[model samples]
Target: MTSPTSRRTVLTAALAAAAGAGTVASAASASAAPTSPAGSSAAPGALVDNRFWHTYTDWRCGTGDGTRVLPGPRPGVVIAVPAGRTDYTDPHTGRTAAWDYATWTSSVHRSAVPATEVIASWNARTPTGTWIQVELSGVYGDGTATPWFVMGRWAAGDGDIRRTSVDGQGDPHSSVWTDTFSVDDPASGVRLVSYRLRLTLYRTPGSRLTPTVWRVGAMASDVPDRFTVPASTPAPARELPVPRYSQNVHIGQYPEYDNGGEAWCSPTSSQMIIEHWGRRPTAEDLAWVKPGLPDPQVCHAARQTYDYQYEGCGNWPFNAAYAATYRDLNAVVTRLGSLTDVERLIRAGIPVITSQSFLKEELTGAGYGTAGHLMTVIGFTPDGDVVANDPASPDNDAVRRFYRRREFENIWLRTKRYDAAGKVRSGTGGVCYVYWPTRTTPGQQRVLRSLGLL
Candidate 1:
């Protein structure tokens, strides 16, 4: 049913809106330089830039049409008035209807590290019959502009519209592959120098319902192409008490969501961390799952994060958005510089979900190879090896694994690697999902701040 090498894997692989395409709105706000994901370091090796607009001022600076900035412990933007109405056809369901909509566009942001790839993420509360669309447009180093690419169409639940991502979007400079905005060829030296995000919220007509967006941002990077990455000695060895769920156990249970369980590494890992923070779907929420199934919440996660367009549950930002839907939890899609960064979070009692691709022999003890996969980094061994909850295992009992430090780091941090056939392919270059609670312990805050995650 799915292509073997389609951008969805060797085992696997990796939206939107508005009937009125003629509507346009823009505003003027101050611009700022992007900050490195690891910190303010200007090191040449600091190739990742993370810029998010979340504070009250961040919302105030946006050019908004019928949008209001909510200020408090957590500030966000909601539709105060409908800017206009447009009919959107749910591509998955083939249902077309009209809805009132408003938009908030961020001011232009210049990347501190000019990027060859970019991925956008957001945290929002979309009530029933409501949803939000996020888009990114940017300028190249040559000052040439790129078309606005839809990053995601999201909602907290599936009662209204099927959450999805857009495809076939690109310009001469770049193209959007699944959820990532990538330069057609990074070897040409052309890169996205800066960008802006646009959030369009929609709800049923004449209803006061609005989607409150708490955070919206993107991670832009220009990681060097290499078969390996620089190694680092581990720090403060500590293993987190993270739960594990094997994707293989449910292989044929819900084939409708990304060909069933075999391709659910992203959502599976997400559910593990979400519960690590003590949140889960209610019985009513799990009512849809048939009885006798172990960890139905994993099924719930698969459905909640399923992307109709991509036809897979591996969308990076969609997984992060799913985690944020829980109370008091905040999640972002970012790139870390090294395993030391992951070690810092582990010491703070936080486990991280990381994206990478590797051959079976490349990572000793991994029974299979994948073009794209996600694993939870729970802790480290005394020998500095990686302790992971690998969802690809045959059962929950087989989920915990200790991968050799040198071997795991190269597979997880490298931007390029050779497949089983020895053909070169792109790596995630340290892309990960970092989730934490709104109320964090002092130790958590201190470690998060040290890594620039706060």
Candidate 2:
């Protein structure tokens, strides 16, 4: 399996550069203290800083061209008037169609931490024939400017245009790998000092329907270079009753999506969380799958989240975007500081889907080495070992297993590692997807807030 290559591991050139990049921005508010939420015990701050713009004030402050803000509890931006109509050819379908479009560009956001990498995530409602594109342009620590990068072109469904991540986008200083913006080399110590996000809303010509974007933001981080991170103390042992689904079970399924289920760890893990939240694709959603498949939901998730450019289902933000497609659910791709942050989430009934790369010997009982792999961290054992719903299992039943805590954390949280060939490789550096309901309970909201997620 090529790339066992999760998001940033698919390419060889500068793949190791992925390790040094940092991730999240808080257009909302940065939690300078982990103790902001009463009773929280995480470290001073998560390694990442998140800045999400979902409030009415944030939209009003942006430079809008034919776009306006919708006010209320869940305010968003929508097309006030067509800035213009343009013809766009769907790369996947080769169908050229005219669309009415509008845009909003955010004010510059200086990173609380000089970030070596940044990942952008958004929550929006795009109806049929309406979609949105998110882009980022930043100034490097050296005061040099970066071009605006197309982070994603997305619609809730694939009928209009295939939701995708733009490839071959970068500069002398940095590059966009799948969905993450990474500095060319973190060793250079040249980081992104500030940045702005631009949102372009599109709709079929003559249609009043417009995409409403609820949130658009970036995560910026500068995890120190380390092959092994300091060990985190475990919280009270507890396990969330998360469902398990193995990607191995869907082998040879849909050849169109990344040559089938063999590379669908991202979506398979996403489906598990969707179901754990009491949400699942309807029979209509699974109708496209061949009848008699054991877990049609996983297959459905894979297709819905596929990125045509990457030719794989492992695009990090794409998976989070797909999970948010479910009713009332909200998802974002962000990095957690440590397992202690995860424990705080577990106490709040949240399960984290983490990205990491490891050798067969690095993680006990994994029995496999991957340049990159995704697994669901469901709970902790009494002794603080990990209980995970790993999608790489032989079967769904075997998806749940335990691994030594020290080994798991080192493998999952480290930014650098030695590959099976004894070559230097990049690790995910604690990258993860956190999903929850929009109308979260006060306690859940508190936990998310404490983590700088709200």
Candidate 3:
């Protein structure tokens, strides 16, 4: 095993070289395993059906719902890409297990530690061979963040895809070594998925480090065939100022209200995007919209005309909630349902505004506003600020504000239905809604700049 001190030395040297460059060296290759499909190294136990595919989180256990353990690898992990692949499967019922994407969360688990973090994944192609890809997105630690540090490794059968990978005999069942160290050796899907992932956060012997485990899968399989590789037509980049609009607004169960009785939660929010930001719908924007969602079975003619694309709480398609069970938040729920619809939107480079309605009514009553509503967050900010596109006032336009990070995340948690109660103890249903611009793509940025969203 490489000593902790040695690991820190390696990371520091790499980071020092990366300073000011805005880029980190990624693993040699990001290709999938290349074994001929299905020769069967060892079959995974059983693919169980799970419903959390819409949210994101760590430590997915393949039970009857979202995941199942295969026979060969006990407690192995699978990362699916190109968005619709199932990471785990049950041979019995053909049921696949998954986690919700919206709820997915990650942490190093070590307290006060700074070191390189590598996310490894194991994947298999049905029948014959399995392909696995691993990469390092960035180095995140106290007061430090970088989203561009990327590296990847891929091995196909006995032939290594990347020049940096170590050669394996049959299928990665141990006995592999790379240039870095013996531990960083590449292996096959059969062996990689067999063991629980270890949270390896490099730190000094006595530094306070928090341990973190990243959740990999989405509510559903929504990853693309290739990440790390730039899109063929890079979507234009436009930054919008998110708002804390309606943070004090209340919610009710009245039919008049849009988001679980909070009328302004979505429509009004959408209005802000158009009226203030000058974002209108384009042909592509209209392509993914879905109406009458976040409360399934309750369809409205108005929303269904456009594809709302977002499948998080109170979004569309999966928008069904009964007094009896959890809410459905998707227009199309093909597999494990936890991957949040917002994730898909962001990946597609669509700028969005999501709202969290407050439950103010009595628990026994049908409608009420418990907390604030109508806040917005854009793409993740390196500064940890809650990004927003507020239209309330010109001063607050398309700005990044450092709202109490913890508080802001907590509020979003409540809105996403991840929070059981308003204050964690006052348990009530929580839901979030997305407000997209009429236009899709950075072309919206062109329109916004012409209209001064700049």
Q: State which candidate has the highest TM-score.
A: 1
* lDDT (tens digit, per residue) of candidate 2 on 1-454: 2223645555544333222121111122111111111121224444677777777777777778889899997888999898888887777888888899988877777667778999999888889989888888787866777767788988878999999877677778888887888887889888887778878899988989999888888888888878998899988999999998988988888888875545988899999999999999998878898989889998898888888877888888888888887877888888887799888888889999998888888888988888878899999998999999999899989999899999998988889899878888788889999999888878898988877677
Q: What is the TM-score of each candidate against the true structure?
A: 0.92, 0.90, 0.25
**Every model's Cα RMSD, please?**
3.7, 5.6, 22.0
- Candidate 1's C-alpha runs over 4 A off are 1-5, 8-45
Give the winner by lDDT. 1
Write down the lDDT of every candidate, Cα atoms only: 0.82, 0.81, 0.24
Residues 1-454 of candidate 3: C-alpha lDDT, one tens digit per residue: 0001111112322122232121112221112212112112111331111111111222332112112222321222232111122232322235443311111112222211111112232222211122222222222212233222212122211121111221221111212111111112222111111111111111112323211211221111111111112112223333444333331122332222223323223333433333334333344434433443332111121132111111112221111110001111111111111113233443444334443332323222213333334433454444433445432222323223334333333333331322224333211111233323323467534432221111
Q: Distance (Å) between predicted and true CA of 96, model 1?
A: 1.0
* Cα shift from native, residue 40, model 2 (Å): 19
Model 1 clashing-pair count:
6
- Runs with alpha carbons beyond 4 Å of true place in candidate 2: 1-46
> Considering summed lDDT, which 10 consecutive residues are worst modelled in model 3?
320-329
Indicate the worst ten consecutive residues by lDDT in candidate 2.
29-38
